[model samples]
Target: MINVIIVPAFQDNYLWLFHRQGSDAAYAVDPGEAAPIEQALRKHRLQLAGILITHHHADHIGGVNALLQQRDIPVYGPLSSKIPAVSRPLADGDLLTLDGGEISFRVLAVPGHTLEHIAYFNPDEHLLFCGDTLFAAGCGRMFEGNPVQMQNSLQKLADLPADTTVYCAHEYTLANLKFALQVEQNNPALLARQQEAQRLRAANQPTVPSRLSLELATNPFLRVTQRAVIEAASAYNGRPVDSPAEVFAALRRWKDNF
Candidate 1:
């Protein structure tokens, strides 16, 4: 089994460390800072095998150079002109095998939050390391991409197995759920999830790796086709839902201000 450790960094960013049991080889997803990661490696007595870059965001790849100086670990990432030093440029449908274990992952070009954003999926492990694309109860802001692209990206992730464990890069669940509640206050699933998140936060615990099923039930972005979300977006934007794309656009606009 893969043991995952979440190293909190730079306010809300999470650098995920993945390693198999009875092995010293380790892999990190989005090491925004090198100091903490280096310390963690020493503390755990593990060797860095590779680095996975989700995007060119400084908050995601700021520590690549520092980490590389410590060890010549291979770096894999999406094809971005802005990214200077990716050893392996990955594309959609590419498979990455790590360790001697039967571990394999597929690359998904999920753009929207960023034009070159990508997500890594390990079907055998039912794990997804989606940088900023899909968040618990929310989605990323359309910074470099449009609502249509983001919607398509989200749809692709939503089609994953219900039990797929989603590992997002930030701790935005509480804020995202607050917005979701405003949109779907009557949704019992969302309400219960909010309460659970509150409890976890009260105890100083991390609310992450949320299941895909929960997101499908409560996330407003994922429910764009539902009547409640469509009506809410239309009413909020003062526009009629001519199609799902319009609803998505309006929802994205509302969330931008929200």
Candidate 2:
């Protein structure tokens, strides 16, 4: 009975708020600012129970101190010293139960965008709060980790059940889909996804929380082993990119410049 609500923050950031259906206690994920989260809480008539941080990025944890000043709630995050506000430091494979044990999540160490990044997955609910590690059709920039780390991180996510709903941290779907088309032009699934994303954007709606199956079909980053993606990455690098990690690196570089 856990329900998630999207609380739009900065230009493209999306802060997630989740609570049980009949409960007023709620938790926020990647709340970069307190104002919007507070507003959302008031709007939903839910009280802040805790906070969840995936990485140490400012845009993801900027509001943690401010929120703590208002309410002394536990802050759960990766086992990194960078974010000192994390009261409950978690590691890979740690199981966290919240809301009187009605909601539970497994911590997955998905370091790529940042060396300390992690993701939360609720197996029973088929939900993934992946922060900036994996996006709708793209991924975060390699600010700290290398290609191998990112590729492995993405592979871990790809191994999740196909029905998992990806709740990434940004609103980069349309833009990512545009780049996906450049790498896999003949993919009808990508084309259809672009059309659907365009339609959603035209109406000023969010295109996040996409199914993992859709991402597997249309996301170039997740399709690094595909022939079309490999060819495109090789063409971009002016050399044959054989390994999946190499293809992922090339695609990431292309998107960085795109």
Candidate 3:
């Protein structure tokens, strides 16, 4: 089994450190800053084997050069010139094997937040490390890609096994759930998830690594096809939406203002 350690950084960003059990070498997903990553590595007594970058955002790749200066390590990231640190630029449907092949991930091209954004999915472990793409209940802002790309990307993730654990890069569950409630106030799963997430946050806990099933059940972004969600989107759009992508576009616009 692969173990994961959460390294919180810069307000809400989470740098995921993962390794196989009994392994001294570990990998970091989206290390925004080097100090927190270095501290976590020392505390866990694990050497940084490699770095995984999901996109070219500053907060995701800011510390890559610094970490590489300490020790040369392979930097795996999207196949784009936006991030020059990527020594192993991966493409869609590519398999990434690391840590002497003990850890392997399928590169999924999930371009919504950025044109080159990708997610690493370990099918055997049922784990997903998606940086600034799919959050606990919310997804990243469509800074580059359009609603169609974002919705399609999220669908690819939603189609994953229900047991998959989502390791998103931010802690935005409560806020996302609040907006979700506005769109689907009568949803039982959304209410339950909001209560649980509130309890976790009140106690100063990180509400992440949520199950794919829970996201599918409660995340408004993933529920564009649902009647309630489409109704809400149409209400906000001032017109009826005919397709799931249209509903998604309207919902994304509403959430952008919410």
lDDT of 1: 0.89
Which candidate has the highest lDDT of all?
2
Better of 1 and 2 by TM-score: 2
Name the better of 1 and 3 by lDDT: 3
Q: Model 1, residue 113: displacement in angstroms?
A: 0.5
| Distance from true location, Cα of 115 in model 3, Å | 0.2
Q: Write the per-residue lDDT of candidate 2 for residues 114-213, one digit (tens) a residue.
A: 9999999998888999999999998999999999999999999999999999999999998899899999999999999999999999999999989999
The positional error of residue 155 in candidate 2, measured at the CA in angstroms, is 0.4
Clashes of each: 0, 0, 0
Please report how far candidate 3 places residue 69 from its true position, in Å.
1.0
Each model's C-alpha lDDT? Answer: 0.89, 0.95, 0.93
lDDT of 3 by residue, 76-148 (tens): 9998888999999999999999999888999999988999999999989899998988999888999999888
Score every model by TM-score: 0.97, 0.99, 0.99
Q: For model 2, state the Cα shift of residue 214 in Å.
A: 0.3
Q: Candidate 1 — which residues are off by over 4 angstroms?
A: none
How far does residue 28 in candidate 2 sit from its true spot (Å)?
0.3
Evaluate residue 80 in candidate 1 and report its C-alpha lDDT on the 0 to 100 scale.
84
Candidate 3 local accuracy as lDDT? 0.93
Give the per-residue lDDT of model 1 (tens digit) for 65-173. Answer: 8899968778999988877768999998899888875577899999899999999999887899999999988888888998778889999999999999999999999
